[model samples]
Target: MVKNSGEGISKSVLYLMSAGAGLVVANNYYNQPLLNLIATDFGVSESAVSNLPLLTQLGYAFGLLFIIPLGDKYPRKKMVMIDFVFIIASLLIMALAPNLLVLIISGFFVGFSCVVPQVFVPMAAQLAKPEKRGRAIGVVMSGLLIGILGSRFISGFIGEYFGWRSMYFIAAGIMLIFWVLLKLKLPELQPDFKGSYKALMQSLWGYFKSEPSVRLAAVRGGLGFAGFSAFWTTLVFLMEDNFNYGSGVAGTFGVLGIGGALAASYVGKLSDKMNKNKLITIATLVMLVAWCVFEFSGHSIIGLVIGVILVDMALQSLHISNQNIIFSKNPDARNRINTIYMVGYFIGGAIGTTTGAYAWQIFHWQGVASLGVFYTILILIFHLVFKKSLA
Candidate 1:
């Protein structure tokens, strides 16, 4: 049962909160479809335009490190509202950017501010009972997955039809509305960590050092995310160059991943009854196989569709599994544990994105596929070493 409030979650409220959180998180990803447009507008090389994704992912890592821990020390609702405002500002900046550097900078702030979903997920898990926590998290995560997958198409359409800059204007308006809903509907909670900022930062490090499961999950998710990102970061280029498709066609690939995102809702239900370590191992193996499929199918549309579905499913499943493990560790420290795991995950993503971009520039789709496989191998190796230990 849902625990903290002694009442079941109102379905409407739950869905709204989840959707709001998902929209906030989507800010981190909308640039993928816009990269080519931005390159053309700024007269920058593809690799230079690649900085948008690379730096945005990096900004997420930075926020996960510095901002997420604040969840434990402040009122979450206020923090979320504040974050929404920052997102609006950042989106506005991106919409009006005069140069590549300005757009990159705005993308960074947008990413940094988008970590609100991390806070929201943990808060949802915390409010629910241990038994319901997985499902609650699953519900919230479903929204996140939808936003991630949907933004590709929706944002791509907005960018293609109106211009890439117009997409940000729409996002900014949505964020403003979301802020009002958050302010009106969310409950207030007291701080869990009462220490000063410096002390809290130190304690965060302590938690990472002391928690075996957190470290294991972080490494596991980090590797998995790296592999997941490698394929996606370079996918647009492959679709455009090899298939002679535009961003619109590239965005349609998002549909392939929706099944996986929907499956994430069930993953938590599975986690409630299954051996999480085994599940994670299975997910990692699937990820490796998915990358192999992607590498082999880079030239075939049907092959690409199959590979995308498998890869997205594997990635989302592993993501849910990792969260199930980490959040179960300490309810009070959920924010910090998430901060650590996400920091690792996004850093891995940033590295993967950067490497994929340059590799795409030099070695083309083959290079991108190779990087995905390499990261998948790293994830598999990490699982092999720690699966027993995690168990």
Candidate 2:
């Protein structure tokens, strides 16, 4: 295995990194489809169990702000391996937790450790040739999208048949196997920033202040993701209320979102050759159109499916373009820049989740659709206001 910085990333290495990212990120979402099952097992109300996702996302946001920047100051492989150990431990804790409190805490740690995928993203960007950088990130991000969308399908099935706790046991075992593979095959990357941890974090603020592209990209990504999250979170409600479907049917939407995964790599490659601002404008319009489709679909599965494809494609395209812009500017501080962007991204997701739930409580599916369009409009406004600045 190559251990030096001079070694170029091979296709095999890219595939391995992509797979690793998917596996690690899957930890955060496994609980989503299993929330009801978990609540039943622990004798808690579904409302109470809702805190689990909130806590988990909060932990993920925390890790993005604090743990991800460490990639700039440490060998990324070592950091990732260490994180896998925590991931395994956290999953095991959730598997064995006898009560909701323990499960919540363990879920937080699982989200915290799952930030390993973010580490891999910057590492992939850094290792690729400049011409292939966007493609590389796209491949890894496709894995991430698959994990995010696929976890619901996998966990829902597992929770139904094998039981929810069994899903955690299986996940912990999978993480252990991934940890071994990373140790054996992942290349060692030297620290780009030599500084104290405090200073490392302080530099994040400096990047936020000094890097206009980072700030712009973060806002665009965060808002775009807010719309994406609003749609997905309320989707279950739409399926159950209007279509009279269960969680299993809701889970199938994850399978449908594979359309996004297929498009991600292509979108990344396109971002490499195309003008990013124009790409963002096109993506933003696509997202707005997707919301319009959802607004009019009214109980049509076919319409929902088409809207899902368009929304996921649009969001993933904008995300790759944003990352390409941010990473291209700062070769030495990719991790920190990613931290800023992703922290904003996850925060937006949290806001979207909350907004979707509230909207559903008020106006049902139409409210949710409106919420999504509002967030997408914010993305367009940001793009238009900053187009010259971005140029």
Candidate 3:
């Protein structure tokens, strides 16, 4: 396949990439809503089935570190196609698994192969004109965020009406259709790094050491995500304990967050013209205010809805800004750069999840709110201290 020499990506291709990203990343979250059904089917405790999400998240983090960097060394189209095959295989295994252990293992592979979205994100940035890079990324990321927010709803509906296994079978069939579309419409992206696998891996650390912008972007994005995750991880508990609502009411909050997804592209355009550091500082402050909203309005459903909208929009804005800053530092190393940024981002999310759960056990809603504020404060301090450097 020859490399494309294009000034801008077409809307059709961009839409395809966006939809593909959404579908691929949604695999990681599908099991979240189906855990109970899975537990009953496999004759296991809910506690045991809880490990499915954890193992899948761990697999995703591993893939971000080890597999995503390969995008820099290989044709991404080929790599993505191969990953789709593996994803379909994993989904099939989950559909047909006879035991909990087999289902859990298949869950890991599903998470691991879903790094296909990460691969396409950098490719989108690479293919876009420099002035339009942030908007392009925003469009693609909107799809990714939508996938994360919507997967639970879709899976819950399908699992309730049909069965959990049916959801996997349907997802596998969708991936097969996507595979054919990608083969026909996706442009061939040439590798930028020509090196041994070991050296390619080694270069990741070099990027972290040499690129200060990458470090700052990664830290800022990570802390913001930590705050975001802290709130979401404990949201259901807050709804149940404070308002006596059920999981369905808690799930409706994800729908409210679609406002944030719709705003991502506009935010990306702002990042292109504005001072990214200032935008990040403002975004962090908005997140802080969001936590304040949660703290004061913890008992009100209306308050929770308002807070969800603010926090999600703020988080997505900061995230898009962070990517623009890092991508500007090294165009050729976008894949490696993204790997470094996202690995930190996901690690922060894991920490936030743990911290939120612990806080909920201790101080309930107040503790969770305090933890979220603390993470948001750290993001603000980093942005303030390094504003000049980041600029």
Candidate 4:
């Protein structure tokens, strides 16, 4: 990646980061639309199969806690490439998994190693101009948004046509392409922190304790992500139960999300001028509406389509805006700050996956909608009540 001292990072690198972020972050989401197909293959119940995403989120959260701080201490290009290899290995294992339990165990490693995009995001913040930091993070995060949405579209499509296992095989190949590209194009960056791993982890705890804004952003973002995860995790189940739709149709719904979700960069740029907390409040409200729409959707594809767009946009708005808040607070500590925020964010995701599965089992879509509503209200409270102008 090239950076002009007065200008900032090159356009090529921005594109690379954007695309790469989408592809890498996608590893965590590939199982959503294929949950039913996967469940059928393993002869398991939906609740049991749900462990795939749940454990993956937990793995991602653990990695965010234990590994992401290293972005601040190691040469990042080297670190990111290393993560890619680990992700590839995990994907291959899942593709060839001998049993549901084996696949679920590998899903955890997949989430653990899929932290590459987290590395890219803070790097974008570090390389961009002070005023443009939000835009840069947004650009990278937009790729993440696409990856989050697109992964489902692709995996659902692939799983329908080529078996669920083929999706993992394809995912591994795509990751390989990114690894080679970044190895050649992405630049090596000097580390900001000079501490032992133990010291680094301890420092993060201190930062989390001392930084109230980081706590707000993490909790608020996490809650919104929980809602986001809850909906997506159970979408395939809904389609199957209500419409007899398979992964292909369920995945096609992901395309609906891509349009409004692309607003991440715009939301990011807006954070530069607006109060980020307020944007978060608005996003949470929208998410609440999205769930209301979802609960009433019943068998209507139109309702699902509308709900997907709203939820994706709201999550993107909440996410990029939150990034704008925390990343702007301290440039040097960007990676450490991100670790604190993302750990909470993914933990929320895991909880949502678990809750959504439970609700879908006992109370079906209505239960999932109620759970989503609960998360959105919590997010709203975190932003509105604890509103502070940190950035």
Work out the TM-score per prediction. Answer: 0.96, 0.95, 0.91, 0.97
lDDT of 1 at 123: 79
- In model 4, which regions exceed 4 Å deviation? 1-6, 388-391
- Cα lDDT of model 3 by residue, 176-250, tens digit: 999999999998888989999999999999999998888887888888877776676667567657787544555
RMSD of 3: 2.4
Off by over 4 Å in 3: 1-6, 35-50, 96-103, 160-163, 237-247
Worst 10 residues of 2 by lDDT: 1-10
lDDT of 4 by residue, 81-198 (tens): 8888899999999999999999999999999999888988888887888788878888888888888888899999999999999999989999988888998889777887888989
Cα lDDT over the full model 4: 0.87
Model 2 spans > 4 angstroms off: 1-7, 42-47
| Candidate order, TM-score descending | 4, 1, 2, 3
lDDT of each: 0.82, 0.85, 0.83, 0.87
Error of 4 at 40 (Å): 1.2
- Clashes (N, CA, C under 3 Å) per candidate: 0, 0, 0, 1
RMSD of each: 1.8, 1.8, 2.4, 1.6
Give candidate 1 regions above 4 Å deviation.
Answer: 1-8
Model 3 residue 281 lDDT score? 84
lDDT of 1 by residue, 1-391 (tens): 1225346466676677689767988888888977888888889888888889888989989988899999888888888877777889999999999999999998999888889889878877787667877777888888888788788887777777889988888899989988888888887667778889999889888998888888877877787777667777777888788888777777778877888888876988898889888888798788778778877786899888888888888888888888988888777778899999999989888888888888888888878778888888887787788777756
